[model samples]
Every structure is written in C-alpha cells, then in structure tokens.
Target: MHILRELWTKEIEEPDVKSSYEYVLNLRERLDDTLKIAREKLEKARGRQKHYYDRMAKRRKISVGEKVLVLLPTDSNKLLMHWKGPFEIVTTVGINGYRINMGGKEKTFHANLLKGYIARDQDTSQATTDERPPTSSCAMPAASVTVVEDLEGEHFNDSDCEALPELGGWGSEETVNDLKYGDELTLDQRRQLEERAIMYSSIFSDRPGTVST
Candidate 1:
C-alpha cells in the first residue's frame, strides 16, 4: 500500500501524467497476477502432497487377519517378553488421522495398541517358544548270563564246596541246589534295547539346540 501510494503521489505531481500513470497501474496489475498464480500453484501442490501421503499411509497399514504389534515409546517391554498375546487382526478403523481398531471379541484394544499385535504366523513360537522337560519315561536295559562248570566234577565235602546258588537264582529250587557248587558267568543282554534308545534320541534330537514345536 505504501509503495502504491508513493507511486500515485508521484504520478499526480507530474504535470504530464499519461505515461507515469500507466506505469504505476501496470506494476500493481503485475503484483495481482503473480499473487493469483502463486495461490493456484500452492493449492495444487498441497492437494498432491495430501494424495501422496494418503497412499503411503495405506501401504503401511495392517489389515484384519494380519498379526502386528503396536509400536511403543520403548521396546523394552517387548524385549522382556512382557507383552501379551497373539491377538489376531479382527478389523480396521481409521480416517487417516488417528485411527483405531475395534479388535476381536477376545481383545477389544485400540488401534494405537496395535503394537501388542504380532503376526500370528511369525509370532507363533514367540509366546510358547520357551520349553520344559519332557514327560515320558524311558525303558531300561536288561541283563543276560551264562554258566561255567566247576573245575572238580566229583562230589566234595563241605570244606571243598560252599552252598552257593546258581547265577541269578534263575533256576528251580532243586536245580539251583544241585548246582550249588558250580561256577556261573553273567553278561548284559540289552543290545537291541540300547541301540533302540540311542536311535530314538538321535532322531528326535532335531539337530542340537533346536526346540521342537
């Protein structure tokens, strides 16, 4: 306004006015034109920017059936395994501003709380990943034995033979009594059982340090 007034006054003071008056009017017209163009271009740029952001936000959004955890100021809670649940994506709700979810019947949490959400497929072993001791009992190996005759085949007095029973008492009372003075040998008889146990453990070992699902 000041510049416009000064130019006007200068034009008025001029005795010959046509040229100066036209100059000032032209200058003001140029200012209006520039302003109009600038405003139009600015509005167009703003609309384009809004559209781009809208598309970007949509691309980043998670929908129902997707498992996602809500972001928080600190991931410390997540690190500690303090966070809960593998809540499934139940629904979506938002208008591009601060949207939220109505969640599922089980967990009716807000969309902002989506950080608590985790992909069901990936997050699966997350909750139950830790392990505990197995609950089954293992079979025991059995033993075997063989007998060896005494060096002396003839009957002997009490001083020569002690009343020692046969190997495992595996014989009848009369049989054991008859062989009381005989020698016996014993051996372990669980080859098949031992091999089965070893094979069973190795097959289920699942490549060391890996927890079975």
Candidate 2:
C-alpha cells in the first residue's frame, strides 16, 4: 500500500505527460486536414487542365454520305504513313460520332479522329481528252479470229488472242474455205492473213506510220 501511494505521488509530480498526449492527438487532426486540402487542390488542377484541353479542341461538322479519312493508332518503324481510310459516312451516331463504312464493313468513329476528304475536280469537257493518258500504243485493238476449219498444222485453237484485224482495227472474222482437194489457201484468204500480219507487225514495231485500208 505504501509503494502504490509513492507511484501515484510520482505521476502527480509530472504534469506535462497528459498535455503532451493531447498535443499529439491535435497534431494528427491538423495533418489530416492538410491532406484533405492538398487533395482538393489536386482535383481543382485536374479540372482546369481538362477545361483547357476542351477549349482548344476543334469542333467538326460532318454529314451522312460524306467521304472522310480515319485515324488509327499504330506502332510502326516507317517515317511516313497514309491514314487508314477514305471511308464513307453512313449515319451519325451522335453529335461528334458517326458510323462509317470501312471497306464494306460498318464501324464507328469519333469526329476528332476523322478528316474530310476532298475529291479533285474532274473536267468533263473535251479538254479532258488532252488530260487523258495517251492511249497505250502497245495495246493492240480487238480483232476477229479467222479460225480455219481445214486440217492445218500449228493452228490457233483459242481465238482469245488479242490481235488487230485485216481491217487494221479490232474484230474477228472466222471463215471456212473449201480446201478438201488441196491444202492451198484462196487468194482472198491470203490477202486477209497478210493484212492481219502487217497490222500486228506494225503494232509491235511501235511504228508511228499509219496502215492504209
């Protein structure tokens, strides 16, 4: 009983212990308030950032049936790339979104990732003939195939071969000459064959000379 009384008296001699515990509790509350304030400030900064970003964003207006190019995210080693699509707008999904036809398949995209496509004006006038690429002289006009019915050696079984006709143009002329007595081709047939041969030779030679009919 005497020792317990002496401990109680020693605690009474130290008056600051209770006040020190209360001070630690108060400091903890202040720290919590500081953290809350910091979090609020961070949120405000994020809001401001979003506001600036939206302010700088461009508004795009597009309509159905319009042609547009789409953007795609890709990892590539190439220095330059062509944008993904020249897709057609099928419908509007919302104010800034649309449904597009991607190579026959339907897909959706946002306006921010799409660009309007402008087609070059095509001249419908006769002047366009000048712009027209020169007709490739290398390509021979369609010709009629004169399939000989007589027994022959090394004959063309398929008339699908593109060749100039005896007329110096494109067409096929099939004729069967009565050569039952001999393997002799008629004079008219010979003339026709010669004309076709000359026509094809002229085409291959790339000669600028014209053939007389």
Candidate 3:
C-alpha cells in the first residue's frame, strides 16, 4: 500500500488490459508480506510447543530383553489400572521404538509410552537361575520312556478310572474297623488306602463270604 500510493495518484491513463503487470506485481508483494507474517507466527508457536514438551521429556535408554511396562488407557473412568506390562523387549524398532512381547504377541511402542521395570532381589535371583545355561556335564540326554500299550485287553482305561471311587474317608463303620486307622493320614498312605479300597470294592462286590458296604 505504501509503495503504490504514488502510482495511485498519477494513474490518469485509460486502463489497458495489456499493461496490468504493475497492478499484479503490487498485489503479489502484499500477498508475499502476508505469507511471511503467517510463517513467522507459525514458527513462534512451534518453538513454544517444543519448549513445553522438552521440559518433561527424558531420554530413555532401553535394550532388547529388558522388561518394561506399557502405558494404556483403561475402560474405567477412574485413573486405575492404566499401565499393563512387564513385557520383555523382543527387538529394537527404529529410534525411541521397541517391539515387546505381549502374552506371546509382538507389539510396537514408543519410549514415551513405556517405563522400565525394577525387579525385586528375589525375582532377580530367580531369573538368573532360570536363564542360566546348563553346563555340559550337568545336561544329561533325556531318556525316552516307551509306552507299552496292551491292545490284547482293555487295560489301563481312563474311563474305568473315572468310575473308581474317589475314596475321601472311611464312609461306614465296616470300613473304619477294617482299616483300623485314624482319619489323619499322609498323602502316600491315603493313596495306597484308596487303591486298596477300590480293589476290595471289586473283590467283595463280586464274591461270596465278603461284605459290601
């Protein structure tokens, strides 16, 4: 507008369509000025935003195999149970990015969305023991047990075992007198007694001179 003031006062000639370059140049200059101001304002806004973000931002160094917790939004309106992991890092994906094992599925996450896991002393000890490779001398070749299936008769049928008594306790006076033992018994003793009861159930139920209760 300042540069065009002299031209505006002296323009007494008939408007020639072929001589409109000067008018177009003036409009172009104004448009460029407006664009420059807009760009400056945008840059300043960006700088302020960057400053705010940088105040709380931190450089998190995470490695593969390290455990981390991921930040996740929850269904509840209350801010509870928001973070979900302790998932192991499987691979490093680009800058500030990692691939983690989430219950056997792999998920990619940014560093800002994760936090490092501080394992307890007991947990560290347990993990060390679990992760330690066995020595050559300690690693014995696994023995393959051959299953001998007797197809000749229907022996060792799981369906038959289901029909057998669970044998919780001595159900009758006859059973109590026959065993002649207290209710309190060790696991092995109880199992043996149960097996005996089952065998007796088969024998006495089928034969004579035997009581069934």
Candidate 4:
C-alpha cells in the first residue's frame, strides 16, 4: 500500500523494512542540502542587486546649520511640485533623516528630499551710479500736465508711459512702401532691409501728435 506517491513510486529495489529509519534519516539530510543551496542563491542575488544600486546612488552628507532646498508641493496643486526652500538644517534625526527649520517650525525629512544651496557672491565693480542732470526748481511740475483718455476709456497719465503693441514693419502704408523687397533678394540683403525697417520704427509711432521744438 503506497501511502506517499513520491517515496513509494521510486523505481528502486525494495528497501529493507529493518533499515527504514536509515532511509528516513538520509531523506532528511537531502532536504537540508536543498534548503542550504536555496539560501546561498538568495544571498547572492541580494548582493548583486545591492552592488548595482550602490554604483548609481550618490552618498550625500548634509551637516547641521547648513542651508538646503527642500522638495515640496506647490500651493495650487499637490501633484505639481517644485523645490521651495533654502531652509536651515537644524539637526540629524537618524541615519538618513534630517530635521529642517522651515521659518520657525522644524520638520523631519529624508536626506533624498534635501539639496545644498550655494549663494552667489555680489560683484562690486558693476555697481551703478546716478548720472542724470540735476533738475532745477523752475522746471514745470509733472502733476500739472493734462491726462489723455483713448477711445477705449484707457487713461494715459503724464507719469505712465504705456507700451503700444508692436505693429512689426507692416504697421503703415509708408513703412510697407519703404520695406518693399524683391523675391530674388539674397538672405544678407533681406536682413539688411529688415535692419533698416527696425531703425525707421520710430516714424511708425501710434502716438496722437509729433514732438514740437
């Protein structure tokens, strides 16, 4: 009577019933060997994965009191995010964690979410100087000037210089006549014509009147 299919169906000479204990002991030893092989293979696989990860992973060490930008979500949308802060690192929490001081509040964050911030040095040589001629008290006060209103109800005050929309070179019929170029003109000649059009742009002003001496 075969109680177990795998042990009973084996094509071998019948084992001596007297030595059944020895056969069971041998099977136990074989099972131990199989388990050992499986453990070794698992360990080797883990080691290989660890080696590849270590090669690509950068080891960043941020010290206490150092300024770092923290990765955070934007106010408009949580999914849309950007690096927001140059918060100071207050202390290290644990192995790969850091406590950052955001304003007066302290928050713990992972090392991966933080980046060091480098400040740029100011250039003293490029400092600007005021070169405008001093205005005399006899000059007319700017507030006394009259304000003009366009047809669209938009007001143009004496103080505010509103920027008009660029009409390119085709703004007026006169500009179009001056910028006329033949189709056969070379690229350099066309570029020169464009430069001339830009230089004469002041004449294509949309202002109400011309300046009088």
Pick the lDDT winner: 4
Per-model TM-score, in order, reads 0.29, 0.43, 0.42, 0.45
> Can you write out model 1's per-residue Cα lDDT over 40-60, one digit (the tens) per residue?
999999999999889866334
Q: Candidate 1's C-alpha lDDT? A: 0.51
**Candidate 4 global TM-score:** 0.45
lDDT of 4 by residue, 1-213 (tens): 342444556634456752574577678889999999999999999999999999999888999989999899999999987997789999998789999989899999998898999865445333432333334333232423443455574444444443333233323344434556889999999998888778777665544457769
Off by over 4 Å in 2: 1-24, 73-81, 124-213
Instruction: Name the 10 consecutive residues with the lowest summed lDDT in model 2.
Output: 173-182
Candidate 1, pairs of clashing residues: 67-118, 67-119, 68-117, 69-114, 69-115, 69-117, 70-114, 70-115, 70-116
Backbone clashes in candidate 4 total 0
Descending-TM-score candidate ranking: 4, 2, 3, 1
- Report clash pairs, candidate 2: 142-170, 143-171, 144-171, 144-172, 145-172
lDDT of 2: 0.69
Report the error of model 3 at residue 64, Å.
1.2
Error of 2 at 27 (Å): 3.6
What is the per-residue lDDT of model 2 for residues 48-116, given as tens digits with 9 covering 90 to 100? Answer: 999999998867889899999888755574555457767899999979989999888999888888999
Scored against the true structure, residue 165 in model 1 reaches a CA lDDT of 36
Error of 4 at 138 (Å): 21
